[model samples]
Target: MRGSVVCKKIAPVGEVLVKVFPTEIIDSVGEEDAHFFGAIDTATRALRGGGVFSVSDEIEGAALLHYINVAESYRNEGVGSKLLDYSLKSMKSAGTKYVLYRETADNPINLIISYNFATDNGFIPIVENEKILSYKMETILGGKFAMKMMGKKDSLNNIIGIDDPKDNRIIKFNEDNSDVFYKLEKGNYDPCYSGFYVKDDKIVGALRGVLRDKTVILGDVYLETGYESDDIYTSLLEYVLILLTQDVRVENIVIQVTGEKRRSIINSLLGEPDAERNAIELVRYL
Candidate 1:
């Protein structure tokens, strides 16, 4: 019987072969032995009579999936499915949170089937993009406007000016007043990992960054709403650039901005035009 095997976090077999035989050998070995011997011989020839083993490194927080094929002559004997089941169970026992199998993007039939399989198995679809944007400090603007990095304990209510009815909607302070934010600030926001524009004693605008790996991802930029001009946005972005450039190991910076929003301000900035030309479409998973 021919069959296939599926496994996770394990190496696949080294060799697989399909064999044909004459009636004499089939009668001598019986149908079952003939198929088994043919498979073994093929495997031996492929591996020079030595067993082959495949192993892979543990993916930080992900599971690996592999498929192996057995000789077609012994198919439909439950070998393939059994192999798959063993691998999946092993992965689950190893604390793997997610599993994935590959398929051709254009294969609609299999795509539909796999989508259902994943959903039924409690896996969510996530989309990722390979596009990256690189920004350099072409010039220092206005001698790095006087700004003080303050901790959230200084007063969350004070920084946001929540009572100010005039800018309440556009400049929301403590928007994510959740426990998660509090913990994050306490642990990683000692220096505020954020940028702010101060006029007098009040904050006029602010940009926040979330840490991921060694890079900081620029998050929401909140301004006084009516202050949507190019100057304000430029200043906020420049602040982030200054902070990022100070870290020599930081090779890149990332910002998520709509195409329309970026286009509105490109002409107002003085920098390399090539930066704008190389902009790529950013995709995210919901």
Candidate 2:
């Protein structure tokens, strides 16, 4: 599949995108972001293979590498590597840079991309030059969900009484249950301030959090969809808030979630929309 692999630029539109990109990511892009993304010429590599990048006047000689995905069948076929090489060559010449903000996901979907992207955890290097560097960027949410800045009473008031979960025990991930943990959330599995909703020794829902200094950064929640998913999610999230507050080290919390409905739910708890802070940013100087 080496010589067979061909990287071609495709128009960034819903019709062409549906064939190459995930619907969740496609639908998640708001109108403003959609326009920003489509402003450039990208490509449709394979069935589930492609990448999205954007360059702007807002940042000089820098670009955003939105994402690069490949189908399972295309794995190890150099499809991903070719796509990256081609995409970069297609970019704004030497000295230009590219960065990406992807949650270090360990799930199956992300694992495949990681392999294609050559990511150790969530980042990979395109070259061995000094310009190549990848590090974890602590994404901070600024708006209604900034628990650290919010008063203790204010934060607690919003989380309480979300939904009554029958029996939820905070789970610390370990060697045995690490596999289950990945299924629940999309990011890397960390034991600190994270847990799952266990029923009969099986994980039904889960939430992941990282305690960084005085601020606790939250990750995505993974729950098997069923009856009252919203209720269960609310309950799990609310319960975690209670547990974190007990730790004297926790003075603030940074939560990252997707979907407008979920955002609205968090906004309801935190008050009104404020502003979103820096989340994931990657830098690569060419």
Cα lDDT tens digits for candidate 1, 63-85: 43322344454455644444444
Give me the runs in candidate 2 sitting further than 4 Å from their true place.
1-83, 86-192, 277-286
In model 1, the worst 10-residue window by lDDT is 47-56
TM-score of each: 0.33, 0.38
Question: How much lDDT does candidate 2 score?
Answer: 0.50
Local distance difference test scores for all models: 0.39, 0.50
lDDT, candidate 2, at 100: 39
Q: Which ten residues in a row have the lowest lDDT in candidate 2?
A: 128-137
Give the candidate number with the greatest TM-score. Answer: 2
Candidate 1 segments exceeding 4 Å error: 1-5, 11-131, 138-193, 196-235, 244-252, 270-286
